[model samples]
Target: MLRFCPLSRIDGQKTFVIMERKGDKGNGKQTQKRIAPPQYDEAFKAGAIRMVTEQGRPSTEVAKELGICIDTLRSWLKAAGVQAGQADRQNRDSRRTRELEAEVRALRKQQAEKDEVIDVLKKSVGILSRP
Candidate 1:
């Protein structure tokens, strides 16, 4: 006879299940109990994804709060078509582009001022030569 016990919790202790096999004590055969991975429902998974995607929380933080591994959370995000660290990279690129544009504008302004000065000097020389 095989007996399976449901998960139970007692006094703040962890939850676990018990399984027993009868009529196998005298046979000297050992049975190993296999522990399965924990399964999360769809709602739980969606919530975790929302925390990282909508709320803008880091994956590490979400994973830690949900008692799961960081990699696992990342994979879920990946499946949902969200790339980790993409936002940070885009922000950096945009900032650099803005800086470059500002520098170019400043250089053009300085060139224009230099050209104006040269034009004034040329006109003064022409007037002196004409006299």
Candidate 2:
């Protein structure tokens, strides 16, 4: 016989299912209690996947932080169509893009400063040549 115990809440959100089973242990009868995997809501699964996919956090790190197995996190990511190395690749690309943009901004600022000095010199020349 199998029976399901009342759902227990952990962290005020996660729900765990406990199962009770009755079996004959050769002598007469014995009861065994087993724990089923916790059931996560859609929001929890999406947040976990977002940590790996958009936040660029490692699945192992995210799993450790969330107190879950790494394999579980990876499975969630896989179901979301995210590859293991895709986050790292995206992070690297974004970092490089930011660096390049900063460099371009710096170069433009330098050019503007040079142009201002040239403008000042041209004004001084016009005044000196005027009378």
Candidate 3:
């Protein structure tokens, strides 16, 4: 249901131009709930694929063990060629892995720069403490 507010109340004119929110019930409607995303890592995905292909286990069983959705796991298998389906999860995984690796490399470089600054500060302090 959409409730509207009057656009112009002058000259006995009553027209609703603004629409209310969908969840507006009584005084004020509660905010919509947030849907959390499915979280998984590359290593975990490789393991799940291994379980289905190498061990000859069902995709549903593997998904149960990994605490992931069966359909999601099956999609992974289909991309990995374990089962017959149409989807290209491998390319997506490759891109994601590259992105993660780049982030890790950048973080490492930042840490090295900080370490150098700390070493320079320590040397200056030692030089000032002369006898």
Candidate with top TM-score is 2
Candidate 2 Cα errors over 4 Å, as ranges: 1-37, 55-67, 122-131
lDDT at 68, model 1: 88
- Give TM per candidate: 0.43, 0.53, 0.41
Clash count per candidate: 0, 0, 0
- lDDT per residue for candidate 3 within 1-131, as digits (tens), equals 55555454454445554454655566464333222445577888889887666555556667788888888887777677666122224444555788999999999999999999999999999999987
Q: What's the C-alpha lDDT at position 19 in model 3? A: 51
Q: What is the C-alpha lDDT of each candidate?
A: 0.72, 0.75, 0.67
Any idea what lDDT model 1 has? 0.72
lDDT of 2: 0.75
Candidate 3 residues lying further than 4 Å off, grouped into runs, are 1-27, 84-131
Error of 1 at 44 (Å): 0.8
- Best-first order by TM-score: 2, 1, 3
Superior candidate under lDDT, 1 versus 3 = 1
Which residue pairs show backbone clashes in model 1? none
